[model samples]
Target chain A: MSSHSTRRGVASVMTSSTYRPASAAEARFLAEYDASAYATPLVTVDPVIVTLRDEQLAVLLVKREEHPFLGSWGLPGGFIDIRNDADPEACAVRKLKEKAAFVSPYLEQVKTVGGRERDPRGWSLTVLFFALIAEDDVPPIDKRLAKWFPLSALPDAMAFDHRALIDCAIRRIRAKAEYTALPAHLLPQRFTLSKMQRVFELVLQRRLTAGAFRRRIEPLVEPIADCFETASHRPAQVYRLRPDSGSLIFEQPLKGARRK
Target chain B: MSSHSTRRGVASVMTSSTYRPASAAEARFLAEYDASAYATPLVTVDPVIVTLRDEQLAVLLVKREEHPFLGSWGLPGGFIDIRNDADPEACAVRKLKEKAAFVSPYLEQVKTVGGRERDPRGWSLTVLFFALIAEDDVPPIDKRLAKWFPLSALPDAMAFDHRALIDCAIRRIRAKAEYTALPAHLLPQRFTLSKMQRVFELVLQRRLTAGAFRRRIEPLVEPIADCFETASHRPAQVYRLRPDSGSLIFEQPLKGARRK
Candidate 1:
């Protein structure tokens, strides 16, 4: 069982990854390759678009109109144009462009979901992406029955294992929240520490000790002069992500439990 | 556009990810679906099998025998037998079973690499996996020009975009090495701390301060009291991963630089 017997060939190679005609033989092989001869899988890129909605984490979903999972909710995603998409990232960018008007500072790949039984349309694979966008940036996507479901209240009638994909995305974002300033992206420009703590708690689904949370977040944020009036306590100082602090990695994971 | 228009539908959904006939129309659509009508892309799973050789990190590659790559080196992987492979992980495991004789405890999906132009045959995508196996555990397969190349010096003639894939795998391994006992899998069970330090350095491509390295690793490993004789220094105690510790994640990354 050699490696050659294992694959439907992709391309020729030379001094690098860029495709170059290695020889006349390889060129002939590409010309003669019958992609239709074999059973190829349907591939797609689905983004789990995340945002803060009414003090809770929500993901955007659209109701399908056609066959297979008609009326079932799905993440906003689709196939590569082939004529337009240069690569997966380009396809991801294009998918974002199609969904809403705003751009997110964080759009990262989570993982690939694939299997034979996962999709009824034959073997299928989907690359899952985690995108964090502001809630106000997205206008209603024309009358396609789009809605935001809170993380704790996802719909039961989900399409094509997309529920699992959203779960995977939440786990990834939570992991990032443990050691980086990822949750800050979900907040406004100048927010109170109390609001920031609530956002972290919302994403992580746990409460953090106020003292430890402040200590860990102090280096990542800088206080502003303007204060946000608090309901009960005195006016709290506002803070923003430090200038040039891109995805700041903290020294430790935030242990949400309070210390003795 | 709606999500239904974005994809070639996978399947019908219900109260869960499992496929079920949500409506009579959905069942009818599945029965009449024609997979051969469209130009679907080729999807494959490639594992970056990694280990240590001669005090340097190495990856196993096989020279291709077929047309697209011909004689160029490739990561030992192939297409999924949709009939047999229940999921992508199973496909990766089957590829490992075909290559050599070893089972790695750590087999993880890194990311998905996809594009239309990447593979000259047609639109192609591969799910990249990171597999860590001990070098000694692998015996030679039926001789087909299989060889191990150190990470620093890979073949210039690589098949597809495998060179980029290899680089991505290395970056992942190095990131884990900073805060985990991942590189320990590259070492023998009852190895010395000195050997562990070397393995980390090999994977990270940087020198580490011995004291700081030991301080970070102490909680992860338990001394067995068996000593490994050194050439110059007194015999060092052998250590293994803590019994209850599955994958030890340290509080901070190992700063490789020495202190004043």
Candidate 2:
């Protein structure tokens, strides 16, 4: 469904056709849209399924098969079955299992995306879901359709407004990693300092000095009894998530530390 | 429109004539259906507008006027006009201005919410926007429909799926205030240590010792040239956000401060 290049390149060009150029009258009208005229509320779910594979953070994507910029890569998501599920998270989980054969280790409501022309179809509102998964644990691919793309690199063409969605997701994920326990999901049940550092580096898209990185993450790491032997010069010490720690481990650090 | 009680409560006791129940088979089919069948992409937006008034942190809210939960309070937001504005932030600003007649001092895309059943109308998705405005700066309400409710005392009934939406927004805001400059938005552009501490307390929903709170935020605050003279006790020193610190001041302290 996706083009040969990457989705970012394709998104830069696709103009939403459903959005009529607003006239001065239309602008004024929308600004004063009588609250009583239309009040239908629309709901949808977007999943930001993040995985760490090959020491790089990636997101699960699906190629679109329909029009309105068809043949593009975007997050695997869809509308909620209001008649069935009582909450949005239930619907998001259901969609993830159906689309990617994947169950998220960590899931939370990220934000909502609601724009008039964000969808060529109509006034569509969306709820975003953020999922964290271990790269190695990613379930078998649903080749019938679906794939995982690194955050740094995505498909050329993305269907609908997914390119913008993906971009927003990446920024949130990187910012969240600094302050939350979210990065732990990217690692195995047990891992070493170096391995953890790699996950941080990939998400941050920059290298951190080992001393500083360890200092930053030290509070959240409870050393496991076992050690993992790596190809490196020394056997690395394994650590597990501190039981008492909260979901997020880092906030954005001072400006100097964040510089590449 | 919303009744004074919960939707679940109303849905349970309401007669079949008012709310139809689907067959088990139909429910199961929907639960298991490939969610991609209804993949019409739509763009939407949700705004998290926060303000501090009367020593309490509050968010701008409007009562829903339609069914599915009419008369319930919720964050005021609407669809982004892609034709008028190319940027998501710009769209969010427009929504705020149009609906509430207020411009946010701090606005950023918090995350996206996309779940199928999130909207009862149809397949709609939403992009969540968060803004922080000093309570005093809030413009006169031109729209009689909107209201601002304290974060601590949120209204019991919220429209649509907004209870969940506001819950997520509050968590992000509270968590952000602990380690970032976000709390400053609730304070006057120039404020005192006591005032700053009060904003943190209201947002975090926890009592921090004056000594500890001061120590924690001291690094983030730069003593301004001015002070606020109170009727009682010594004059309090005022501070402003360090301009060079940028958006990521909170990440460091949060990473280092392990939860007990």
Candidate 3:
């Protein structure tokens, strides 16, 4: 046995060093193993950047210039720099800015993908991140290699497990939209009721009756009381999301009569 | 530079192995890097086994017998065996069964914990699984030195960021219970409405009005006529969950009800 036990709390292996020591019994038990015996795995981060463009839901993707499935588009992602940031979410934000010039978006941890053979290079675990941005505010695609793709028409031939990653992200977003204020993150700071409804419609892939949708969202939003004059027949009322409300609203059932 | 370039089209990655090949230019760009330079990462699966015992929600934990936080208690977890099961969820279930001697509870992927230094062993990533088992059905506590601790009174010392892991799992369960039928997993196959309600109350840490809770749950259960034999006072009706119904129920709000 190598006498190096990673197991914690066993009393025998404790030693006097900066590295906490394991108990002697634990050290002896783990000594038979060697971390070097297995292949060193790579850690990467994948971002699911979502935006509402022209009332339609979209995801940001990059065109691949490398092999495997060359010329395919996918979410922008890369390896994590361990020394840079203490938090994975922070690393995700930093990477998005560096790779795609996106900043300060509504970002949350999605999940991690770690199938041994999912990646051809070696065993790797990619931390998945979901970010929401207004469609219009997205900076011009910086990486000539990357482009914005509508959620409905994603290009084929994504890299690695990026396709599965995107699928999970989209499903989560749609499911969450039903319960939380996540979709609001995709809209502008100030928007009309109809505009907000359109974002939901596009994400849900179904048309919500205008009257029903408005009634459903009435309590969730407080009217900003500002009028955004439209070129159409009537002026639309503008509204902003209520402040300090966390993601709990989605848990409440949608209010209003179902549109027949 | 290794000639094996893995980066390819984004969407095409979703398709099984028989897709198109990368172009020569794309291959050349990706092939330049030495994929072997980096070491493969360590991926582990940690099971957050939760059960309701003595009318309290508890988590099954093992006392660390080695270094790190020797003597501290934490969730039962182990390294994932990729060769045994293609799915991570399966591996998680396996670990719980083999290590904890428990089977077939409510299991779901909670989240992945991957921060540098989270584990003193080395760079490690853990896929957390949460399972809810009926307290009485749980096998005798593993004599090898594991214990069940109530959610309200977690031990002061725990191994490898498990305190945070448990906290995250609790929040996830609480949020999930509000919208999904997760609490049903904690009860027997056939249970009374009061039993079901108690499970919810314990997990939520709040008392729910019996009438309100029953109204909310009525649609979810299949009423068994003449099946109730009340123990005291009024014999409450007993119901069993409809096997075919999905765990989630989308409740559109009622007309004229307060939205919030």
Candidate achieving the largest TM-score: 1
Q: Point out the worst 10-residue segment of candidate 3 chain B by lDDT.
A: B1-10
Point out the higher-scoring one by DockQ: 1 or 2.
1
Candidate 1 clashing pairs, residues 3+ apart or interchain: none
TM-score of chain A of each: 0.84, 0.77, 0.77
Error of 3 at B196 (Å): 1.4
Which candidate, 2 or 3, has the higher lDDT? 3
Give the worst 10-residue stretch by lDDT in candidate 2 chain A: A2-11
Off by over 4 Å in 3: A1-37, A248-251, A255-260, B1-36, B39-41, B83-85, B250-260
lDDT of 1 by residue, B137-246 (tens): 65555455567888888998798889999999888888777777788778777778887888888888888999989998898889986556576468777888888767
Q: For candidate 3, write residues B87-106 as lDDT tens digits.
A: 56766766666656656465
Residue A48 lDDT (model 3): 93
Candidates in descending DockQ order:
1, 3, 2
Off by over 4 Å in 2: A1-44, A81-87, A101-105, A151-153, A226-234, A250-260, B1-49, B58-131, B142-168, B206-237, B243-245, B254-260
Model 1: residues with Cα > 4 Å off, grouped in runs:
A1-19, A93-105, A136-143, A224-233, B1-19, B97-105, B141-143, B225-232
TM-score of 1: 0.86
Quote the lDDT for A249 in model 3.
67
Summarize candidate 2's per-residue lDDT along B148-187 as a digit string, tens digits. Answer: 8877788875655677887787788877766676777777
